[model samples]
Target: MSRIRATLVATAAAAAALLAPLAAAPAASAHGWITSPESRQGFCAEGATSFDCGEIKYEPQSVEAPKGSTKCSGGSSYTILDDNSKPWPRTTTGTTVTFQWKLTAAHSTASWEYFLDGVLYRTFDGGNKQPPSNVSQTIEGLPTGDHTMLVRWNIADTANAFYSCVDLHVVAGGTDPGDGGTTTPPVTTSPTDPTTPTSPGTCSAAAWSSSSVYLGGDQASYNGQIYRANWWTQGDTPSNTAWGPWTLVGSC
Candidate 1:
């Protein structure tokens, strides 16, 4: 009887070890940071005439923008733009993102209005007809995914120029800043905990973002859990042309 009991105990220990959960793997590191900057034609205008341009700046220290807003040293005719509005090809959503930009000169008024996907977000002045240089984020928040962030200095005038973002990665996780203990909604698989309170009116874990479409896949590395490849996946289509890796999900 004692011998039999020992065998049973050993079997249980082996099974327990096999079923134990593993720690999460690190997320794939983001690669290919901007290595080279594109050439800028580089225009300059300072303390000129109103409706023409006095002092101006390229908002949001960035390398992708070609034309930027101009600030004036005197008077306000800073309105009217048929060719003044433009946007970056990127997407937005989530909480917020910071932008890098440089200025050539300062507008006399030093203020700017921003538009996110055609919706007005906020506006601020550039202040002083100062020389153009570099500036950080002037505005924040614009829905997630792809979006157009337009900063027009003289909305009514085009001579002032504009700064458009080509691609803005708003990133995910648009949780409220004031709230604590908030969790992101799960997608495909049920969340580990259903009772866990989610942000009010947040989509369930099964719901995917507008940019994230379900497709076939071969493999996935989520939180260190390696889901192998199969045919006809539901998470995402394989990046490659051949199809074999399947992304399993709750299709129903």
Candidate 2:
């Protein structure tokens, strides 16, 4: 098993040498984070059947975080920045990660970049940013015992290079690579009562409101989950009072 793992690591290093970067730890609120004027992710998405950004692509992209929607469905594509963005699980040495990425349109040339301690390490930027390049880079030089591998995206050209797809595979110490293998643990879900009820009794069509509800960015509780659409209260008929001002459920 160790031998297999060793071989896998070597192969991954080689492939990553050929390819190129990109998690999150969620808490009650967004706090203490590494912010950068320049921030990005190398998404490792293999392809689109599902909306998965495998990892952050070093290439430029338009993949922004969602505004207000269930799942990572719709919103402007976000540029990578650690400025109190969604928290990600810690990264460390001997961790083998793998994923895919895509760009809106490739320029002539691009580069590979590595960040150490929340700073830019090396950039493989060439003459232009046009190539639909596949990249992979390993984080060498670990300081003693443990550290977090915070990776983001950087474009040869922000104007020309726009990202489309990505995904990631990273595990501390060692493990087979795939999209941050540790995601929300497998759940055997059953319907539970709402901690706070919108209606006095049961939620009903009659309880629905149509007041123009403004879904604010600050009200976003889940990293990429939308509360507006889900558990929305509609009006009896399209009246001015019922016309709308719908607030997201459970989020004042």
Candidate 3:
């Protein structure tokens, strides 16, 4: 073969090899964010806030970056999340709050971390396995006040982690945010009644019925525990675990 023909073929092969990776490179595999207690991204995605949210409103699950970032954006391109100047709506809650996450592409997770205004407060073992599409974790003994929380979902096999920020206005005896701004009414009792409980927390809530429709903050007693509905639900049994729409408030 002629030298020029051989040289031309070799150059073409090299160019193709260089361009192949650029054409076929895959995007990073990461997804998920706290939805309940409505994270900043969650509020944006739901159109619950009036401020401009940029692309994050459309892709709430993509705030991913290296695992070490403390920023709400996780150092990703969604920097609008880090802006405190925006009037971000805060979830009002009691000392105990339940956080729920929605996963589009679940990964083998290493751990889940919760930070309150940049301080690590709680963590859950991910078991280094894929998680369900809907996952919930409740944090007990949370300090009451207005605060920002940063949540991290660490991938087991990758250096990337998903980050979300949630604003909370925790007040004493406050109900969960989804409860539509009303506090549970105090149970009434007569002084002549000998069977009435002395404490409100110990008072028996209305018994949960399978045929009844309940809305957010609606309380009922189920299996000796007091449970509150996170949202409109019917026939879902109240549970203390992270799997159901009912949140176990305390023992009746």
Instruction: Report the C-alpha lDDT of model 3 over 100-199, residue by residue, as the tens digit.
Output: 7767677999999999999999999999999886677777788898999899999999889999999999888976543232222221122322122234
**Highest-scoring model, TM-score:** 3
After superposition, candidate 1 runs with Cα above 4 Å error = 1-94, 154-161, 174-252
| Count of clashes, each model | 54, 71, 0
Quantify how close model 3 is to the true structure by its C-alpha RMSD in Å: 12.2
Give the winner by lDDT.
3
Give the residue spans of candidate 2 off by over 4 A.
1-60, 63-86, 90-100, 127-129, 144-252
Model 2: lowest-lDDT 10 consecutive positions: 29-38
Q: CA lDDT of 28 in candidate 2?
A: 19
Model 1 lDDT per residue over 1-252, tens place: 999999999999888777664434232221101100100111111111134321122211121211343221112222221123422122333555443233323334344555665566777655534423333342444566655455444322223334432234455685322112222222223342322323343222333322443221223434322332222234453232222333333212
The 10-residue segment with the lowest total lDDT in model 3: 181-190
Task: Order candidates by TM-score, high to low.
Answer: 3, 1, 2
lDDT of 2 by residue, 1-252 (tens): 999999999999988766553113221111011111112232111121223333332212334332222112113233222322344333232444422232233434444334444445444454554433233333333344433333333344342222222122233456323233222111111122222224333222223234532211112222222232211122322222211322233422
Number of clashing residue pairs, candidate 2: 71
For candidate 3, list the clashing residue pairs, or say none: none
